[model samples]
Structure formats: structure tokens, C-alpha cells
Target: MATLLELREEPHWSYSALNTYLNMCSLKFAFQYVYKAESERTAASLPFGRAFHIAATHHAQSVMQGKRMTLPELHDVFAQWFKLECAACTNLTFKNGESINSLTEQARFMLDALLARWIDWNNIVSVAHAFKVQVPGLGKPLVGEYDMVIKDGETTSIVDWKTSAARWSEGKAGRDFQATAFSFAYLLEEDHGMIPLFRFDVVTKTKNPSLENHYTQRTKDDLYRFQLLALAVERAVKQEVFLPAETSFCCGDCQFASACKEWHRSSAAKHICMAA
Candidate 1:
């Protein structure tokens, strides 16, 4: 198990970072390579997600260590973490008439649903486990933390917790690159020559919260495809080819939109001045 400090010292690529590069190269470059003048603000959903993960992992670890917490105790833990996070984050903005109280209630509902159905304490092998692995074609080591890993007899399973407004489709679970990467990382560590079942435990934040589970397994072919993708991303990053990909969906929510727009205006002005 690598310490957080040790992991930071090593060059590592994460699935989320790679996805950022694919989504918009300029934004990725700004975040990864360049230091921004100001710190990026957190989105409303981020703290909510973080608090839930903290509570879930805390419950899992405590149970594994022979200190089982009751559901109300778990809720108390969630509330404490959420309150701390909300207090620390200065730029949290609620959307569409969503207030802090409403979000807290939704979190409570989700927590109740999760405690009722998701956790099987006896089966969990590890929670929030960190790993770093080298893919054959990728330049940097791939690193990630598994939400939960379970060992049941001879079968191993990787469990990921998700909080969303809607349930993920079966097909999405089958094609998720992050889950596939987790499977590959696990296999690299274990060398068991067997694929582990990937499970996504989703909790929806609606008027009435609900829980859904989606399961899939990765094949050798999926790992090969990921290797190719990683190699392509490595090459692009090395070349410093950061191009802006403006889309209605991404541009609206992008934190670096203002930076990209400013860069474009300055570049246009430079071209005009040179021509004159």
C-alpha cells in the first residue's frame, strides 16, 4: 500500500484526468500543466458526493475492524463531514431552488437507502484502497483508489459507489473505462489470471431516493483497448497539442471557459496586429 505522499511523488495518470484531456485539451492542459491564477471553485454536487463516500468508507472500515456502527451513527458521521465540507467551501452554489437543507435531507434519504441495501460488511476486503500500476503502452503509471473490494470465497469483486439523480444503465456499466481500469489494476496486483466482477452501487438523489446495482466484468480485449487509448493520450500530452473543443454541454459548465475565451481573443488580436 502506497502512502498518499509516495503516490504524489510518482508520475501517475488517472482515468478522470485522461477523460478531461479528451473532453477539452486546453482545459486539461491548464489544469495539469499550468498553475491557475486562482483556485477552482467546487461544484455543489462535489461536496455532497465526498461526504457520502467518506461516511460509507468509514462505516465499512469500522465494521471490518470489529466496530460496527448503527445506521443513525453512520448518519451522524455523514452530517459531521458534510457540515465541515460546506463550511470550508466558499463557493458552493445551489441550483434550481436547491438549498443546503434540501441537499442535506436528500443525503439523509440516500444514506438510509444505502444502509438498508448496499453494505455487506463481512464480504468487504478493503475500502478506499490505493493502487498504482504500469500499463504496457502507457508512459506513466496508472493510479486509482478502489471504493470497495470484496473477497467471497474464490471470487473477488470490485464495488464502486455512485450518487446521481438517475440510475446508470446496464450498458454504461459494461463500457465504463474507470471500472475497466480498476479491474486491470487489481489483476496486475493479484496476478490471479481471472477477471473480477465489477459492481456499481448507485444511489439516486430524487424526491424519493432509490438504490440500484449494476454489475459487469472486463475481458482481455478491454484491457488491450485501454492500453491503446492510454498510449494515444500520452503522445498527445507529450506533444503539448492542447486544442479547445467547444461543445454546448461542456462549454456551459467548464471552469476554464473564461481562460480559453481570453486566449482566443488575444490570439486573434495578435494576428490582426501582425497583418497591419
Candidate 2:
């Protein structure tokens, strides 16, 4: 099976992309996937979350191999990635006095909380496992990675790790489209009769970090609805119907803020004016 990076080379959709289109903004998606505009700067939180994710991936892989990392070791893992990510980032934007050092402290605290609540089950099936689902009527496939997959007794679960500044709200997991799409992908690709459980392990960022697990399940009807949504998004993308969600909360932190402001001016209009 091709890795997620390899799968990404071809035209495809993922939970993140769909979230950007549906929840974030469509013009942002067009700026990214269509116009291929480069972001002026990388947000500080973006790299911080990614570094934490990479560190968590390391921890999960170690657990799968039956050798969980110690707290200091895990902190070291996170620090290494955070430093590397920050160095590579161009024009890293920081807000509210956030710096590399501050984020590192937060990562340490979050990891400590995570290790304290670590479950001892070791029936690891896959870590950072990638999957590609082919939906009918769409030319492309939906490709993504399952952070971790494990079996406890007869029940199998797909686990995703997340680091957040605040605790997740009630029923947020149940409403997440990622869980729905991931559950749908697992069913189609694995051909499992039983619905695989979807779980999110979210760690909050604070002086005293906390870890919480939220579980969600998707049924056949949910999967059917998800497929229909995928088809609709695909149709919209094909028609080049991308538009800005001006009132979106995400606009404050949008990467394409500049491009969005200039969206009203088009090359076609410029050419027409010159001809006149």
C-alpha cells in the first residue's frame, strides 16, 4: 500500500481538505489546492500542533513495539521535532507572547498528562496507518492516515491523537466529520462486519494539562450520508464554485488572508479593461 505522502501526490481528498472546504472556507481551499498560492507565513500554532502530533506518533509507535518511552524521553522527542519544525518554517508568526520556549513547556506538560493516563493494552494492529477509499462517481480517492489501530478482545478501534488549547466540548467527537469519514473508510477498506470504534485522545494545553478520551461510532446510514457528501464536494470542486466564507471564524487565522482580500480582482477583468 502506498504511504499517505505518496497517495497525496495524486489528486485526492482528505479529512483536513474537506474540513477546510466545509468548515473553514472554500476560497481558502481554492487558494491552496487550485491557485496553489504559498502562504505568506506559517502560524506558530500550526507547527506547534504538528510537532506535538509527530511526538505523539513516536510514542504510539514505541507502544506498539512494547517499549513505551519515559516522560523525559517523550519530551525530548517533542523538543527535537519542535526545534526542527520551527527552523524550517519561514516567517513563523507568534501571537499573545507565544514563543518556541513557551510552546515547548506546554508540550512537556501535555505529554506528562498523556503518559500518566496511558493505557497498558498492547494489541497494536497499526500505527500511522494510511488508507485510500474510492468513492463511485468521483475521479479521485479519499486518502488519510489512521493515527493508531488496536484490538482489545473482539473490538477494534481507530484512535486519533490531538493537542488542544482547551478541552473539547460535549458531543464534539460525535459531530466530527473526521470520525465519520474515517469510520466509513475503515468499513469499506477492511470489509469488517462490525463497526470499528472511533476514539480521540485529546490533550489540553495548560499549566496543568489534562487528557480525555472521546468515543464515537458511525453506522451504515452515517456512511451513506458521508459518501453523498463526498460526491457533492467533488461536484462543487469540479465546477470551480469556490467562494469565500466572509463570516467564518477561521478568517482571523487564515493563511490566505491577503489573497482573499484580492479575490475580487481577476486577470480576465484586467485584460478586458486593457482591450477597452
Clashing pairs in 1: none
Candidate 2 wrong stretches, greater than 4 Å = 267-276
How well does each candidate superpose onto the true structure, as a TM-score? 0.88, 0.93
Q: Candidate 2: lDDT over CA atoms? A: 0.85
Q: Clash pairs of candidate 2?
A: none
CA RMSD of all predictions: 3.5, 3.1
Q: What TM-score quantifies how close candidate 1 is to the native fold?
A: 0.88
Instruction: List model 2 lDDT by residue over 1-276, tens digit each.
Output: 888999999888888888788878888888888788888778888888888888888888888777889989999988999999998987889988889998898788899998999773577788889999886666788899998898989999999988887899999999899999898888878566566999999999877889999999998888888888878877878766677799999888888898888876966335445655
What is the clash count of model 1? 0
lDDT of 1 by residue, 139-182 (tens): 78888888888988988999998999787766999988888888
Error of 1 at 86 (Å): 3.3
Model 2's TM-score against the true structure: 0.93
